[model samples]
Target: MGKILGIGLWVCIVTLGAVYGSIYLATAPAGPSEEDAKKAALELIRGEPITIPVIGGGDVTGYFLTRISFMMDKEKVKGQTLPTTELMTDQLFTLLVGNKMVDIGNVSSFDVNDFREKIKTEMNARLGEGMVDQVLIEQLDYVSKEAARKSADGGSRPMETTTVVEGEKLDEQPASSGH
Candidate 1:
């Protein structure tokens, strides 16, 4: 009877220890995640404002004027040529023209978060996973075709673009003459 009791006690102790160990492990805080790694050593690269014309029903309706900026991994982009301007332009065209993401008539219904997430996903896929930490919208607005035409007739000069990297101005160039 004593041997039986000893064996039972050992089993119970072992069971308890196993349960405790599993619970502790399950509740323990995890180490730094993939998102944390992406956040490390980030560099801010602000691109020029891109103007995308919105066409619908066989005519030009309006334009999507947006300034796209990014938080990129400094270490990962150290030796690579980041074609952010070209990529962003292509993506914007795809989203605005090809996908018809934004409805000009119902501007308030646009989902800004979804737009940002899609841009980030597409950009990261092209640049490599986790290369683009965040896609930021510094400016986003819509200009009606009539409004744009009026602005042009009023002799408003086009704004110049300046590439800003890490809060420092890199270079300046004239905005594209094309709409």
Candidate 2:
């Protein structure tokens, strides 16, 4: 009886060891090494900056020359989750050009965080999910038509406005009914 009990105890210990070992292996963080992570970062797909002129600011007189970039995961491209690059850029162009992001009052009045979130959300939806990892504000410049014109060759138009998005127009808010 003593021999049997001793053997049973040994088996129980081994069983617990096996279970814990397996659990540890299964749950361990399996991220790549630092070198690999850096390599992946270096190889990330960076979308072109979407530059546009924002044209309405309550009483403010200048337009926001905004530029935004999207950094996407390469795996998205490999896994067929991201669409063609041209399509992505087109969609981004449409979003920026069609956005209701005029100055409102001044640079301080524009909610960059809100705009960023909206771009991320809507862009992902347009791309069919997981296409863009981040939407970065590469540049935001505010210049009045006059300033832009002055900066140019005294005659050329301030940077020509991009073509309107093919499928959509700038959304106009309905006039409020005076109470």
Candidate 3:
């Protein structure tokens, strides 16, 4: 009877611990506010025409130049349009391209969350205590129009290559070979 009570107590303690742990993990606080986002956006735009590079391999050349518009509190601001413009031959644009190429070299994927966080960090650095409501990519694409035209003519870019194998074939050959 004593052993049974000990086991029951142990089980109860473990269950309570698990419940609390799950609750703690589920309710983590979110970062920043809409007001903060707007402030950050405004601060970032002050240095306007921020260009970032789109990194790729093999026959891909060039970077992306981004022009920041305004930063408004998501909850407070109503009906805003993002800005867009063709690649320009401006000094700021050139600096943006160079900085982006050095910063995001050979990156294959662009996660939106990661970009937003980066923008937030940058804004914080530029405007101490002020935060941007959001980082709107307003315009994002490869900088090389020539490369884009070439890809269009080829029907597919180099990054689309993939290998496929059937389940039955996998059993007959090394898993690494796929067939």
Candidate 4:
């Protein structure tokens, strides 16, 4: 009877310890940011902006220069025997190539925050679930194709010189010349 009592007490103590241990682990706080390597390792995939022609209405309308950075799952990426940088950059390039000038330049029509979220969603979809949680826009710029062409043809001038008159916008167009 004495031996049985001792065994029962040991079992109770073990069970209580397990319950408390589990609760502590379950309620523990999350680790550091994705860029931190001390608490939790993170991998940064960088992409530089490149000139890409924008095709619309069967014509090249403009060009886009875009750069993106993504925070990837460090553990998973390290485990794989693949070139993580190339993989991530290719995915980013694919996304940038798919956007139109209007999609990027019309910040007034489309909210910049919404566009950022859209980029995050698209990046995650390509990189895999939980692979990328953060997307940073390093650079994004647009230039009309015509502007580049004119500049190449020794024409240097600013486009869309505007003046305000009674809360109205007035855009001055370039004058045509004939010899």
Ten residues in sequence with the least summed lDDT for candidate 3: 161-170
Clashing pairs in 3: 36-131, 36-132, 37-132, 37-133, 38-132, 38-133, 40-131, 40-132, 41-132
lDDT of each: 0.68, 0.57, 0.43, 0.59
Q: Where does candidate 3 stray beyond 4 Å? A: 1-60, 70-108, 148-179
Candidate 2: segments with Cα more than 4 A from true spot: 1-43, 55-63, 79-85, 155-179
What is the full ranking by TM-score, best candidate first? 1, 4, 2, 3
Best by TM-score: 1
lDDT order of candidates, top first: 1, 4, 2, 3
Distance from true position, residue 129, model 4, in Å? 0.9
Candidate 3, position 146, lDDT: 63
Candidate 3 lDDT, 92-159, residue by residue in tens: 34434434432333435545567555655565444332434555554444446465456667846542
Q: Which regions of candidate 4 fall more than 4 Å away from where they truly are?
A: 1-39, 101-106, 152-179
Q: What is candidate 1's CA lDDT for residue 95?
A: 60
Candidate number of the best lDDT: 1
Q: Candidate 1: global Cα-lDDT?
A: 0.68
N/CA/C clash count, model 3: 9
The sequence of per-residue lDDT tens digits that candidate 2 reaches over residues 64-138 is 554455655555555553344555567767776635664444445667678778888887897657666666665
- In model 1, the worst 10-residue window by lDDT is 159-168
Expressed as tens digits, the lDDT of each residue in 1-179 for candidate 4 is: 99999999999999999999999988846865554653265555564445666778888877765655665567666654556556655666676564652554444554555656777787667656676666666655567787778867778676321111112121322211110
Q: Provide TM-scores for the models.
A: 0.60, 0.51, 0.33, 0.55
If both were scored by TM-score, which would come out higher, candidate 1 or candidate 3? Answer: 1
